[model samples]
Structures are given as structure tokens and as C-alpha cells.
Target: MTYSQERNKKMHSLLYKQRVLLEHTGKSSVFISNDSHKYYTNLLEYIEGDLERNIYTIPVLRKAIKTDSYEHLLKVVQFFSSNTSCLFDVKYCYELENMEYEDIQADEYTNYILYGTEPVTANGSEIEDFNPKYLSFYCIINMD
Candidate 1:
């Protein structure tokens, strides 16, 4: 299949998966919440950009991980680490597993990379730091 066809297929499959998740929540199928709709819309946009611009996006990375597309996944990781103001946390078990499965060296993965200069805060004065780089990663993994 051509690249465009592959991207369309991926988007359709993701939409179908989201529909199934919505069904499981016992919500009306027609009433997709604004947040969910926005998420899907952003996801489609990212996928299209990845295909057309030859750039890797977060959804692409997540799909690569899911399909065991290790090389592409690594490329995404590297791209986020170097090119974007994104930070990645390597704490999740699944992420660890992906790293191991792909035989990615620990050093190669940017360590404690912070995505933004401004500190992330919660509960006024309690500061939390998060890597913004993996925003795309989170979006893809959390896609219902």
C-alpha cells in the first residue's frame, strides 16, 4: 500500500478503537465529549503531517511501539529528544519494556530531559517537573 493509504488505514483503525472504548463506557455513541473529539482530531492531524512531511509524530511513535516497529520508534525517540522542547520520562513499566524489547541503550535515551523551562506546578507552590517532549507519546499511548 502507498504511504497515504497506510496512514488512512491507521487513522480509521484508531477511530474504530476509540468507538469501542466509548461503547464500553456506556456513554451515548453520538455524544462524544469535546475533549475526546479534540484528541481524535489532533491525532489525525499528526498522522497526516507525519506522512506528508516525513516527520515522526507522537501517534506514529506509539503505533510503531505497538506494532514492534522498533527502528521507527527509536527514530521518534531520538527526534523528540533532539529537535523538540519535549521531555521524556522512562519510568513506566511498559516504556521500560519497550526499551528493552528494542534493545535501546539507556545512555542513548536522553536522561532526565526536561521539555520546558517553566516549572510545572500543582496545588499552588508544589512544583512538578514533566518532560513536554513526550506529550506526543502520551497522546498515542492513551488513545483508548
Candidate 2:
């Protein structure tokens, strides 16, 4: 597979596992709170230069939560699945080396190498690097 295709498949697998874990842990679904909305709004605005330029909007999230429909989040995930390169942090992409689709589906430890939510630190300091461009298109939709 091409680099982008491999990356996209790996990401899909990670998200699938995460959702399964969330389901088993009694969480009905991930919710986007007010703070999350604000954070994502800022991130999207920075990346896209304007949220208006994108198809997604802040109000859409508000409406989803109100109506108890997570279709918006699903759509975002679908977009991310296809545009993994746009949302992935290129700096850490080296970790993806040698990971095939089959291995990703079979390995329970894929999270540690991929999108692990737990903080990773170096020299007693936390490091954060989120891909801004298309991340605004998807992850903010979860923001739990």
C-alpha cells in the first residue's frame, strides 16, 4: 500500500479499538462539551484561517448533542479515515514503519504506537503535537 493508504488504515484500526473500549467501559458515546467546542473552534480557525471556509460548523456540534445524534461525529471520522495524512502529525509518522493492516487489526498494543491518548513525556516534560490542518475536520468531533 502507499504511505498515505497505510497510515489511513492504521488510524482506522486504532479508532475502532478505541470505540470498542469506550463501549465496554459504560460510556454511551463521546460528547463534545462547551470547552471542547471552544478549543476545536480555535484550532479549526487557526488551521483553516476561518471556520466558515470548512463544511463543518460549531453549531452542527451543538445540534448533534441536543438531538442525541452522533452522525456528525461519524461523518468526521469517515473524513479522517480517508484523509489520514492531512490530520496526522508528520513528525511522529516514523513510528508507522513496518505496520501492516493485518498487524494493526491483530495487535492489542497498537494504541501505544499510534494515537494513544495518554501523555508521552521526555526529560520530565510533556510533549504535545497535534496535526492542525485536517485535525479540525475530525478529532474535535469527538473531543471527549
Candidate 3:
């Protein structure tokens, strides 16, 4: 598929996950069984990189947050998606699980977190401060 088509597919999937899929589970952290994982993992095979540089990751998280947290994730993803950028560390990342590339032969994968934050705006006003961050996404990514 062309780049535009690829991007649009990712957009549709992200929107489904953000609005439909997760809503069904009714939880922030949803676990997928190994069997189910197999089905969905390849769905994003056309995606360029892992969640590390994935564009869909942050937007979903931003929309998930009720207010302040939304601003931070948006800003961070925007910067990290680029070559070099940061805005007062509006985002942060910690790998709850780690898998290596080589080890992935048997069981390994690339899961990198690039964090930074954006401003939470209210009526064109952006909130800038030390706001607590929350988990907005639990994605199954294949970092190619």
C-alpha cells in the first residue's frame, strides 16, 4: 500500500481501538490472550516502527485522559515522532515489560518508549505545570 493508505489504515485502527475496542473491555489496561494477540499483531504489520515512533500511540492516550494528562501525551508524542524536540518534559515513559530484538527469534520484540508532553489547553489556554500522568494505552506493537 502507499504511504497515505498505510497512514489512513493506522488511523482507522487507532480510532477503533480508542473508541470501540477498549470501550468494550471497559478498562484502561486490557490484556489480550496469546491466540487473540496473534490475530491483531499482524494487522499492523504495515506500520513502519514500533510504538516508540508510532503516531497513533499518543493521540489515543491524549483523548483517553479527561483533561491535563491529554495535553502532556500529545506534546510528547509530537516531539518524539520527530528527530529532536522536547517541551519541558511534558511526557515520560517506563517499560513495564522488555523484550530484546535478537531474543525475539524465539521470543523477542522491540518495545521502545520515547516520552515527552504537551500543553493541556482550556479555551485556548494551555496548562503548564507538574501534573500527574496516567496510563492511557496498552498497545500490542511489533517494532519493525
The best candidate by lDDT is 1
- lDDT of each residue in 27-107, candidate 1, tens digit only: 442323443343333434454445433344445545534435444454434433332212223321112224421222232
Ranking by lDDT: 1, 2, 3
Cα-lDDT of candidate 1:
0.37
Q: Model 3: per-residue lDDT, tens digit, 19-110?
A: 34423432332343443332223323323223233434444434432224543444333332222211112223222225211111101111
Local accuracy of candidate 2 as per-residue lDDT tens digits, 1-144? 886566455545554554444334323323334433433233333433322222333344334223333454443333333333133211111122264111112122234436654333223232345322212221232211
RMSD of each: 14.6, 14.8, 16.3
lDDT of each: 0.37, 0.33, 0.33
Model 3, position 47, has a per-residue lDDT of 33
- Candidate 2 versus the native: TM-score? 0.25
State model 2's lDDT: 0.33
In candidate 3, list every pair of residues with a backbone clash: 72-118, 75-118, 76-116, 90-117, 91-116, 91-117, 104-108
Better candidate number, 1 or 3, judged by lDDT: 1
Query: Number of clashes in every candidate structure?
Result: 2, 0, 7
